[model samples]
Target: MKANKASVEFAKKVSKGTPYKFTIDTLIVDHPLKKVTLSMGESFSYIPFRVEQVPRYNNWYHELLGRRFRNYTVFIESLGKEIHELIPNIYRGESVPLDLFRLSKPLKIKQPIVRNLSKASSYRGGLSNRNIALWHSHGWYYENTQDRWKWQRPRLFTTVEDIWSMGFVVPYITPMLENAGAYCFLPRERDTQKHEIIIDSEGSTKGSVYLEKGDGFKDEEGSGYAMKVPFLVEGENPFQMGKSRRMPVSKETFSTISFIPDIPEEGEYAVYISYKSHEDHVTDAHYTVHHSGGKTSFLVNQTMGGGTWIYLGTFRFNKGYDQAKAMIELANQSDETGQWVSADAVKLGGGMGNVIRG
Candidate 1:
């Protein structure tokens, strides 16, 4: 059987300079015939029927085969927000931690009386994906003024009735893809590129290093320099070649350094920077990381505040290139404006319904 041309082309593109070989497993059909008595030159006929324990085959493509390719694209797009939003933190090597808190006061009812009751119920309700709240009552009693009985009988009351009872209230949680890391490096003395300097540590590393721009090491322009430090290896130390000791960053002081290494493996990395903004907010911003052939690339993005959202999408690459190329490819792929096209084709045939016997 002949292979499809588009599939072949896609294989060629992704295989360019890649060291690893890819093999696609496909499903096969087998026909077993029952024994039949026949004479020489005698012909017989039988109705064709498919026989198998289960309907579908087990395979990655098979499972995903029937699904709308566009829907998959949409899913990846929707999921990209989560992945990209968390990439910065992932690149920084941080994990999502769950924090639970108890409500001290009943939430102020906003809607109409009816809506308020419903809102209150929602807050004092059970666990949910977004947030959860529970309610408990303090034992107390009050006279029912509307009751007409001569003396108000001892009224039975639960804590919920006396005091507003509620439980666990959670914050809006955005999913984070962890272990994402990224890095950008340059030789000791080189022209610094715009948007190329910032890196996302993703809550992974404590600090980053970048080359200082211009020859103002002696002036205010060089007094306290700032650059985006992409995520780097956890234990790998970032230092300048000629500098002997490491300098720590202080409130008003900035230290100049040599190179920042790229992540150790193939994965998503976020962009983050360490700089004192005009508002004096020292933020560790984050953005996603893309790699190709092991070379690092930089995706320029707006600055993010502390605890901002970033999504890191799925990673794919050619292995033949060195770490630097892979890193670059990662950055390029992460560009919010960059386009990513899948290589697989949509299948439509099922059984022998349209088959013809010769």
Candidate 2:
């Protein structure tokens, strides 16, 4: 089969105020083709499935080295998320964790959610020429420090040599093409280039990291999960990065996470917040998302989601000393201890997404 070209369909609408509901449509392409639905695929540690939950610990213990590395067998057994079926190469599959829906800001669709998954551009019968399928898989392992997983990435994956590594598979995951199959990387660059401003919540060597459980509120152990978790450097972190974790963000004279505006002064921009519960401890965390437009408050059970970028709301703000900075405040009174209450990172649309009048 000589293959080339694919398409993806996704949609999002304004929610309440600045927040929006974003969802990708599920397409059915029964026959096998050369298609692949890649997501955060650029990420070495990016797992295809969503992280459901983690075991909890009291008093926040510190691990200098990192999580212990379990043997391949042991690690696979403890894998919490299930391996979902691939969208098949007859040519269509996109995103991770199958059905994915979250609070997202309005933005134009940049790349095809679906793409050709076959390693060979042309295949006939059981024989073909060229293996172009991408050989990829990732998950958490014993990094012995903060980084839980070692990561398996195909460097020359797009070049050659990677044809050997393309066949590696896990328990539940099925190969989109046959093992020893050749697949090529299809480039989907139709979307316009995006400009984004990311504020790392953890203490950044670049500046004062947005670290806060609450003011003057330090736990007994004095160990801080915020300081330990890796910074949001190109979406890389040992522990899950973003928002404040295990700290009570006091509403009074305090915000969970904050960052100053660096460009274009201020205007109408879509707002986004990234944070997730790490372990079994699930608390209904309350938040008042503040931006240039105004304040929108809501409640969320952080435990429900692993690490994710959530749409809080959108707004218009002016550029000033403290005016342009974005902030997420923890408002849940019941969440007194801030145990597992996390606030990691925040994002401004930088003039992306859709702007509905409703």
What tens digits encode model 1's per-residue C-alpha lDDT throughout 1-358?
2223323333344344545343322212121321111111101011111222012111222233333221222111011122222222323222432222322455442221111111122322322211211223232333346433232233346323322221211111111101111211211211111112222222111222233322213211111222123333344223210111112223322333223333333333332222212222112112222344232222222222112112223234332323333321111122122222110000111111211211
- Note the Cα lDDT for every prediction shown: 0.23, 0.36
lDDT of 2: 0.36
Candidate 1 accuracy as lDDT: 0.23
* TM-scores, each model vs. reference: 0.18, 0.33
Worst 10 residues of 1 by lDDT: 341-350
Residue 308 in model 2: lDDT: 44
On the 0 to 100 scale, the lDDT of residue 87 in model 2 is: 21
Error of 2 at 38 (Å): 47
Give the clash count for each candidate.
62, 48
